[model samples]
Target chain A: MKIRTSEYIITEVFHSLKRNSWMAFASVGTVAVSLFVFGMFLIIVMNMNRMAVSLESQVEISVYLEDRLTDSEIKAIDKKINEMNGVNSVTFTDKIKALDIFKERLGDQKFLLDAIEGENPLPNSFTVKVVNPSLVKTTAIAINDFEGVETVKYGQDVVEHLFDITRLIRLFGIVLMILLAGATLFIISNTIRLTVFARRTEVAIMKYVGATDWFIRWPFMLEGIVLGAMGGTVAFIALRIAYNMIVAKIYDTIAFFPLIPTYPFMTYISIIIVCCGIVIGAVGSVISLKRFLKA
Target chain B: MIEMKDISKVYENGVVALDHINVSIDKGEFVFIVGASGAGKSTFIRLLFREVLPSSGALIVNGQDVVNMEHGDVPYLRRGLGVIFQDFRLLPDKTVFENVAFAMQVIEAPRRRIQHSVNSVLDIVGLREKYSCFPSQLSGGEQQRVAIARAIVNSPALVIADEPTGNLDPDTSWEIMDIFKKINGGGTTIVMATHDKEIVDIMKKRVIAIEDGHIVRDEAQGAYGYEN
Candidate 1:
């Protein structure tokens, strides 16, 4: 009689769940574990991408200047390099300034740099920041052909390898995430199928008594959705705590390393995990019930 | 009212379950369909409910062509009918009250109306005291009664019982027949398929006999008419 929609569905869902409590737990656990792994990979992939982008943007091409160049000629080279298509900025480092940086970098070896300080053989250099990392090699070659430039040294091998590795990591992460989602859907639905199969007679009776397809479907769908959302929520909370602890430990040990901070990123991670959980749960129920719905 | 014209059903495995059958069932009548094992009794009943569509010809139940009915409307068509099985397909997990109440819930009957109708029907079936008892707690006879209660709870114009007393003892079978008599008295058409000769001979209802996918006899107030 005029039953409230949610009340009826929730009662049915709870009844079915109670009848198949063990199977429900298994389904939820499967969804949770799969979702957890998927979520972990997503966060890793996101952070790695951020780190890669930051590193790429900071890639600088260093052009060591000849010691015999006049001041005006060096300035002209600076302007020319700056005017190149993809160069964002050009900063000049004179020989004395370069030696000072060398001394600072050597820390305990400052006395060795002091022996050659007056007769410094270090060359002046122009450090160039490129707008796009993929064009760094071309920009470096163009700058090398400049009249006064002695050598164009840009950690070429290391930078190219870093870009390649980051690209591969991103592609691998996407493929792995898709596979994990497919696997999660399969496991969740199979688990749900066990429960649905057990109660098939009830479903048949409902059909026999004139219950609409949706009327029969609502309870099972609700059960799947509730289980999935719960699994996702549990995984999200666990990830948050684990991520925070790990980040705290890492930051404590390595203060200068860049990481996407816990607070904002976790907020996004929670949304993604919960959404996936609900969608996967609904999809699983639908897939499992396909045979039964024919009647 | 129910009518069938040239209805035929052929299974995928080459078994001809129902072959070119035609029959009509009038309103407010009690008819018994009696047959031997594998005599197409089950297929005939299944055709009425649209559970298995006939391979050919028209089936009109309640003025709608079941053969051409939309898949979505099958459930609605079923709402006008009450069906009971030999095994008393009750939800073992639910109590008697919930079992009967589930029928009304499926049709979206109001809450108070469901409670009222379920209680009244349970009283009719003499299961008022066992409202909270699960199917496992009830005897075979009582479980069949509960199944009857569930079927009739929605007050359909037609009740189709397929061997409603198949699992009950003769004495209990009489008790189930008494309930069917009471329901028929209320002006509801009933088509029952059974092999219970003693009950069929005593009730003196109109009997239609089928053998090997064909109707052999159709008589008024006939006996079971089988020597075996």
Candidate 2:
């Protein structure tokens, strides 16, 4: 572990990289491209999943009450729905107010409402929002079974399909990330292999001269790690710049899309990507040297 | 020191490279193995460095049982050896100093000591002024000399040269031989395999001759006593 020896190894690694600059660039480029896609996919998945959760949370169920109920009876039913499990809030609207809402909803059709002027046909209802949107359907069904409830609806079909698609997309993102990691390792090692193959004679010479296997392996491993880190850094910077631009554009046009705010979340993601790069680099170098290092 | 009671090697293709080769080389002895092509010289040299295992025999080098040694122990066994090759296997891009310095670096020698020993070895090979020269910049003889300096830099007890002068001219071969003699006289055991008859005939050392996988002769103070 002499400083001089370490310096020699570092210089040797850098020299070899300089000598095979073309292959070195190719290795870095491959790593950068693969990791860039992986980072982008991760960012997008984070935002999409957050957006889905937000949309799910905003869903509310409407329970139309049985007709001919008095004010006290309606109050009693409103209190019952509010006390139900998972119900965040419940607001009761009587037939008179329902009629007013109908009139507002049909601004140009006020004459149609005047035709039934003396008789109010709208049903009084309770609009209930739940803590967890996923439990909305079950809570609605439970309320529908209540004595004063006539019907319950919460955009049942559309919400179910949305959840399924989000789950599929999450699964796909995980698989793609794993595949990209493998591809990065393969390319980095193969590219470094060309450099190692070129100097196999040096390895043979070192072997014959009684240099230990690790002694011969250190410089090559160092080279690969540096190459991998370089690729990771490049990919991280590219992802950050591109992500900031897209996030700005998305906010300016359609601000409702729920994005993971760029702060600690981005910092954590960058660390993960860079660490992957380093690990891939180390593993690739070790794998490529396995055959040659065998005594 | 080296001992081979009954060493034999058979390739997978059924070629018998060496057969029942029994010989003993003592410590600090300079032995030359002379043979024609396919006469088992290379195999014998390789066996000393544990480059290949013996098919059947008891082989020991420097008091270590080499025949039954595991794969991981081979490098340690080699560390006691200074191996030179026919190709002058110098790193093409490293300067002569770095090439020699590399040996000590592999063994983790301190910088001051490495500097001192490398300089002295370069002086021994008479290449002190050519330390900064690359392999391509040096002539064949000078490069072989650089190879020799690298081999001895680690201060190994035994030096194995497999056709060290195979690619050198007559004068350069003599110069390389002179360095080996100097190294051997300094108490390092030298086992060199070569077919350079003129130089071997001139330098009367202990010569061991192999023919058809058998040791035909093991003579002390002997000449290269074989004809092509």
Candidate 3:
């Protein structure tokens, strides 16, 4: 097709949209709202995962050394623990230092300190920060084999349960996105199908007139794309405004929650919304066109 | 040229619409396919356009084996022919100019070419003044003229009119026939399917008569042969 004619087709498509502005707007509005919900949920799930990771980082593993270890042996074990996979950092806390910190906490409890006597019962230890808190078991196992290490003391049950919760959340979040994507496709396709059905005669006549399939298809495809993108833009704007409002209201109460990534996440979702809108609109137009183009 | 060699069409219910219809028309010939309702005239014309496939036999239009034509080539093939309907089938919402321009738009005719061609055809149909008029705004005859203008604007090799005057008064029908004659005079072959006996007789063109899904007569300068 000539470039000029292609422009005319686009003109016709946009003109049709204007003529049916109310209907077009309604359809686009639905797409925007649906995608907004999907995008908002996505940001929420991502932030929640971030929060979980932050909380997990605070739980450190302490590896106690056996009393018989020489300075060289302790140094060798420290090096091994630090070199282990998933161990982020290792700091040696000498037995005397650990007792001094305990005493500082129990300032008026001289009797309690006396019960422990002058002899320090605490073992010298290395506090380990794991790069991945979810891999605590693996890190504990690696440390357990160290020659002078007495025990790897991370709260096993709590870490395992927390890890399981994060995994479940991530899985459910993915499944939800998949289901919502499918729903968006379905709704957009049905909407375009109705538009195609309403203008089946136009499509039939265009075909009979010897119009190329693409020539006929371009306008409808453009219409779909426009609808999707408009919807996505509206949704993105609504989400941004809504997120800002919610964040402002809950800032103090939710101090433990990480700072909102509203701007960056909005940018990411805008890209997704535009892409999804275009894809869905094209798909919808294609489905509706398939049956009507037989002429 | 258009030719149908022993073409037959049978619906799935075993009702035959056309039975072994063998016919041919040379380029520039103006012929009439005259038959009563359900006599298979529509089916015969529809076959040439590949709108309906012949259940058996070969149908060729301008050397293309339309009977075996692939689905993708149908539109390209149709671009070489124009099909007009009895109901005038102009989009009511579009102005007369838009209706004519639609033909060129489908073929991706450039804006300048489409504008030039639509104006020229509208002039030929003597409706240049009604360019902005919608189908509903025009009279029955005027709307049919717009339909004819759309059909012929592309300078197609063939123009198929199915009961072109079926919905018009005798006076308006005659006006439409004059427009068809003018188009035929321009060297485009014309095939019209109609039940208007008086008009067919007056035109005195070659008439192919069909009855009960079969061609009953083929005569040069013939009249509508059968009476109701």
Candidate 4:
């Protein structure tokens, strides 16, 4: 690989690209479209995973106490829960604090609770967080058996359904990614094959004139890289713009929606997409050049 | 520069291209391989460059074993030989200079040496002044001359051509042949396959004629014996 040969290969790459400008344009467009779709799905799947994780972390058990429990009895229950495995934290909310929270949540409708205000009907409960969200059910059931505990609730059915949906999303994302990647490779290679086919006689001439396989392949490989890089850049820019608009819109409508932040997350996605584009481009060139290089 | 012993070529569809042939060509000998269509002339030229392997034979071209040579070494073997074809397969977009310089570039020759050798070969082909002219801008004969310049730029010991003048008029054909004679006079062995009887008879070089997969005649200073 002398400097001169490298120069020659670079020149040849640009020369062929210029000669077949239309084909090059078509190739770049196809790569961009394919990679854009890939990047879109990548963003969606990543944000879904993030949301699922955040939701899982929010899962906790609530143990309501039986009426007339003394301070010492509540203390005993708290110490027992502390000794249990997988308990991250236990915060006891007294009925008075619960009532205050309910009043705040009711906002202007606090008048609706005026009838029961003096009785202090809200029960004292411990909000329990576990080290692992998946253990919420088992921990809640165990706490329900305690002498002072009246009931345990942790949105059991809702949590189960959420887990199921998130699992399905992850599985579907993986399958979709694989299919899109395969399709991208196929399309890019076919486009490259047309370019190679057009210049097949040129390749034959090179072979007859003693050009080594690599000598002939270098230009095409470089062409693929160039096209891939261009396409990746295009897709990255498009994804960036589209993601920004969507993020802004979601924040405007649903501020608390757990969408992944746009900065480094998108940066990472762009890098992955561009790198995949490059790899796909190189592989496509190799595949397309295989039959022609037999000379 | 080439030796073939007990060579035979049976295509997969069972067409016998060359059969039980034995021939030896020494260095610097100008020979013409002449035959009718489908008479194995193309296969003979292809075998010299190791483009096609004989079904069973020992082939030595330019001191390299053609049949047993490793795949990686094929390019090295081809490097020592120049090959031309009837279509004058020049890159339509490349200038005459670049087209000739391309051969040297393929072998990764030094930049200065490529520039110098390409100029010299273009000079030999009498296209030095047309160095910047593209293939589409050249006449048939001039395009073939450019092809010759490219083939010889690397100073291959042997030049193999198949129908070098097939696409040109009679005068243009003769013009292409004059370049071949000039090249051959410079001690480069040339093996050309052609159907041009006039040039074959006039050149009076050693001729090998093939018919139906076998060489029917081998003569020095031979005439174009076929009526067609």
| Clash totals, every prediction | 4, 0, 0, 0
What does the lDDT read for residue A79 in candidate 4? Answer: 99
lDDT of 2 at A10: 91
Please estimate how well model 2 matches the true structure, expressed as its whole-model Cα lDDT. 0.87
| Best candidate, TM-score | 3
lDDT of 3 at B73: 91
Worst 10 residues of 1 chain A by lDDT: A1-10
Alpha-carbon local distance difference test for all models: 0.90, 0.87, 0.86, 0.92
Candidate 3 local lDDT, residue B189: 95
Q: DockQ of candidate 3?
A: 0.66
**lDDT (10s digit) by residue, model 2, range A231-264:** 8888999998888888899899989767787787
**What class would a CAPRI assessor give candidate 1's docking?**
medium
Best by lDDT: 4
Docking class of 4: medium
Q: What level of docking quality does candidate 3 show? A: medium
Model 3 pairs in collision: none
TM-score of each: 0.85, 0.85, 0.90, 0.88
Q: Give the winner by DockQ: 2 or 3.
A: 3
Candidate 4 structure quality by residue, lDDT tens digits, A210-239: 888988888998899999988999999999
* Model 3 Cα lDDT, one tens digit per residue, B1-228: 988888889988889999888898999999999888888999888887888888999888977889778888998899899999988888878999999999987876777898999999999889999999988889999999999999998999999999999999999898889889999999999999999989889899999999989999999899998774
DockQ of each: 0.64, 0.60, 0.66, 0.67
Error of 2 at A25 (Å): 3.0
